[model samples]
Target: MTGVPLLDPEIPLPPDFPNRMLTHMFASPIETDIAPSGTLLGLLQRGRGDGWLHALAAPRPDAVAALNHCVLRDPRPDWQLEHRSLYYARLYRELDAPLDAIGEHLFDPVDALEECEQRTGLALSVLGHLVTAGRQDALALLRRYAVTGANWRWALDELAVREDDAGLRELGPAILARFPGTEAGERALIEAVRDSFEPRPWHLWAEDPARSGQRERLARALEIGDFDRWQRQLRPPTPQPGWSVRAVLDWAREGYEQTPRQWREAAAARCLGAVAGPGDREVLLRAAVEGPSPVVRAAALRHLAERGDPAVFELIQRAAEEPDEELAQAAVTAYARMNDDGALRQARGWLERTDELGRTAAVMLARRGSAPDAPGVLAALRRVVRTRGTDAKELRALVEGSARLAIGPAVPVLRHIYRQTISSQLRGHTARALAVTDPTFASGFAVECLWDCEEETREVAAHHAATADARVLDRLRSLAADPAEQEGVQTAVRGRLAPS
Candidate 1:
């Protein structure tokens, strides 16, 4: 009834195990270390194929327990990125897993105050997948949580996608009650309406004849949301004072001091480009070499890089060797953005360096470099995936490079990455790549891709899944006519079915 019981009675808890991790846990991706890939927990957490194979071979209770532990604890440090819920949900169905642990975890008293997605996001997401898989209990729990759970917004999103109109209408009063007629409440309601992942429930509520009061409130919120968006668009960011090089430099220094994010430096660089003159070159160059602040130096580096300054490459190489990792990283990033002949040549040299500079160079070449660059891209892809796993930041570009260059050796690595990655975004991209490179795609992964949680994935499946199979036509037809389907997906679906 509390948190999920320790990996079934067949599996003993580790001696260091603390309380049900649902309570008294510190969740930070910075601290989340990768588990040993050979272990079932590691495999499941990483969304790897071996994890599923191991789970099936392990005692059913132990496998279910390990799974429940993962769902309740929320393994991924950045819960928002990399999607494991659908993957986990499929595992659950494969095992015909019980929902008692999931139910208990969602209802645990800790959920009342601890609504941060880090706490229960995985559980909620897994539940959504089960709901789509025709699990009534999962659907029921989502509805219940939507009213009382701290993370009601997420639950509402899950329900919006699959729940019936009658069921969704029942939630309007409970949800609306949380935001009263008070000014703060009104603002919150407006934002909620504006930000809901799916707008169907709001739209349905607004059209319901019986919920006149709810309809009016939703309408008012929508109108305010539209006005807010219009206002934001009207306010284009520009120099506070009429443009001057000194003023822009001063502005960058100030913005950097206030909140030194990389994006601010990039913004300042754009402003500097507009105001800088032939005479101002000395000052900009001086700032790039010996700036008072990192913001100024980074901005100057970006500006020089963008303008293709003859001396820019030297400046970049120098900064990259400097002690400040931040500036060094900035320089490398700036250099990576360049696509001209010199930059491409420089990238070839970087392929041999074993640092972040080298990593970004591989990504750069993967994205824009020619077919001859395939060997280098393939090598980087294998090395990064081996050392850092599929979730590495460079994974997408590496996969794309493989497909673009038609790197024959990359198919194995791509397939491994597709199997191991927790990111639906990454998986969808891999699917796109595989459609081009993998000979087995149409009859293999593409068939199941149609049932994937992400619509982009479904669209990919629609385009490439072997139409010789009977189910392919059925799925395509269903997608073509489904009002909830995305426009791009519908286009693919209709194209596949137009002849029939």
Candidate 2:
């Protein structure tokens, strides 16, 4: 006899497992017309608008299996960046799916190895939303998990947001017991009290006579936390108006010697700009080239560039050629800030070089380049993506630049990045770029984008997706009606559906 599969066969198992029974899931094929959800396994993987529609319409067991697989494994490329909890929770409520799979996943023996929030955050969050939807069973499960689960704090926070006062008060002893009775435990308890997101339970506990010792400890900790914040704000190396340009420079040098923070160095540069007289240009010039600290040199270069000093262009070029990476990046940033025609001329000249400076020049041109600069910007973007691939965070500026220049040729590259990149934010950027660059976007990618995990992507879809497809209109109407949908998205949907 064959051994039973751990999960239902129709559910798409995570790729980490090597079981012979495991079946890989792929996205449903997109066509000119909207297609019905066919295989439950594929519905679970694609997680598009069609996935939700299919999962809801499939057989009860198949739909439940698909829902459980998604909630337990979290199929999104980046959980921190993309949203799946609410999506899964809505499906769970629609199916009235049993919580056995979720319960087993949460309380599994393997939780010892995977005790962090990442493993169970999606399930807990879905349960949290279910509680908000007036599911009493979901609320009870959350309470049980909050008291006994490995990631209890997350559960407790969720309950704090949704559960009644009496419910939260009952959890005090269990949560407090996690801290030991010793002095170290008391300190830990104080920290927990100070850092709590929902302070109502702590406040109620602080007033209870039965827990006087814990209350006093928490009260003192809260006072100390406030005092610490005040002390931090009051103590500083603030700039004074009486300081001369040389004095401010010396102050910057001293601070750099002590702490060497980039923000502090930038503040020092602003101070120099405020105090410098006509006669101080020579000193500023010298500091840009020969300052002992790179921070000082960078600050001076930034100030000089912002002031549009004519000689600073040659100095910026020298700094870019310097072996120091930090200084070179600073020079590039300073050069980008220059609004003069010379900066544009110099950027065009640097565009041909295949160095870090060349990449920086390309980004600057993308941001500030005129309509005439589109071809050069597109060429630079192609080279950068070809060299670094779609995963490079550095390409974001160029991606926006392609949109700003409205480069039609860059549409294919943007679409490729949209499909290949794992970053939700990057995908959102790609969607906005496509909205402007590609004429077919309203009917093609925009339709699939309605099911995109990011709300911003959904907003883009609402604004641009063609409503000729039945699925598009249904999703748009649902979004418009849902109170949970973002106001911006709702507005877009309303505007799109409004009679012209």
Among these predictions, the greatest TM-score belongs to: 1
Tens digits of per-residue lDDT for model 1, 138-182: 988998889888888889998998898998998888888889799
lDDT of 2 by residue, 435-496 (tens): 99999888877887776656888899999988887788888888898876778889999999
Q: How accurate is candidate 1 locally (lDDT)?
A: 0.77
| Candidate 1, superposed: residue stretches over 4 Å from native | 1-35, 49-59, 76-81, 203-219, 237-241, 259-263, 277-279, 371-375, 378-391, 408-500
Error (Å) of candidate 2 at residue 32 is: 34
The candidate that wins on lDDT is 1
Report, for all candidates in order, the number of backbone clashes: 0, 0
Q: What is the TM-score of each predicted model, taking all chains together? A: 0.75, 0.74
